[model samples]
Target: MPKSLTTSEPNVLRPEDFDPPLKRKEPIVPYYWTLDEIATELGVTSRRVGYDITGYPPRKIQPSLKAYKAGSLFLVPDADALAYIQRFRERKKS
Candidate 1:
């Protein structure tokens, strides 16, 4: 039997022996909002988020929202949400 397995040898797994997961060179910063969150923020429903993306002419739902699609999920950055709401007042005034 190997000395490492049979005996408590110094070569046994140590804290320094393991390699950590690879990290990105640059720091990562993510600020995102889900469709459900957007709905709640605007006092609406997730279904309304979809409608806002694609306006419903008959329902008088106009598409005026920005969203980022990562795969099947949609995300709205915090900055964008603020801008969207800020522009809302300007657009209404116009």
Candidate 2:
């Protein structure tokens, strides 16, 4: 048998050597949406998402849950954007 050429110690796995699993505080569902994402999800242009505020009812006619802005980049949380569209439909149907 040939002599071993490597000098590094073996990396044997042990139960006590492992790190604890990560704990998550937030929901698993995708959280935030940019203007482009909102448009893609709703099948419209990014400009439309920016203009319509996630398809919120017109601000003048109804209270609006407007899109958010972060670090000069506009964003809309996924939940809020979907809610805005739902409420828009609800309002229009009535």
Candidate 3:
């Protein structure tokens, strides 16, 4: 009869050692919207929207007027607009 010897290694696994997939509600991706659509959604003039969110030197798509290209649409960041609104509201409350 042969006897088996156990090495000095731990049998349990730690949570940090296990590689679990990251769980998220939505994938992180950039979203773009046209100025007209954004104005309509927020119920404001396009010029006012641009002024309130981005002052001079507005964030633009910079499309080539000479030739039409696929996926040529440009947009400002929605989160930045939302943040502007939040700050505006805070100022109004004060």
Candidate 4:
């Protein structure tokens, strides 16, 4: 038999030799939500949520008049809520 040409060590791997697992992505739900619930998800008070959307296109929902001001029992999309939640998390990390 011919002699082995390679001089490198064998490529055997032990259970402890493995690298740590990668971080998993945050889970996303496929549901719409009301402002109160969205505020909870973003870790903020509901008043702040109201302020965040002020002078912006309102969330799609039936409009009701609260005295002279308008209000919505409408649902905001999960993606929009997630974007706000992401900002909240980043702010907390600093």
Instruction: Give the TM-score of each candidate.
Output: 0.49, 0.43, 0.33, 0.45
Global lDDT scores for all candidate models: 0.58, 0.52, 0.40, 0.47
lDDT of 3 by residue, 1-94 (tens): 1133565553432213222311222322344334544455445686655554334454553421121112643354444433333444456569
Candidate scoring better on lDDT of 1 and 4: 1
Considering every candidate listed, which one attains the maximal lDDT? 1
Per-residue lDDT of 52-92 in model 1, one digit per residue for the tens? 76678999999887788877777776566545544543455
Clashes within 3 Å, all models in order: 0, 0, 0, 0
Task: List the candidate 3 regions with Cα displacement exceeding 4 Å.
Answer: 1-30, 53-74, 88-94
Residue-level error in angstroms, candidate 4, position 74: 3.9
Worst 10 residues of 2 by lDDT: 15-24
lDDT of 4 by residue, 35-55 (tens): 666566556787666656553
Q: Candidate 2 — which pairs collide? A: none
Pairing residues by index, what is the TM-score of model 4? 0.45
Query: Candidate 2 — which residues are off by over 4 angstroms?
Result: 1-30, 54-65, 87-94
Record all residue pairs in model 4 with backbone atoms less than 3 Å apart, i.e. clashing: none
lDDT of 2 by residue, 1-94 (tens): 1235685564433223223311223333356656665555455577655766534455543334566677755766655755655544456569
Candidate 2 residue 46 C-alpha distance from true site, Å: 0.7
Error of 2 at 84 (Å): 2.7
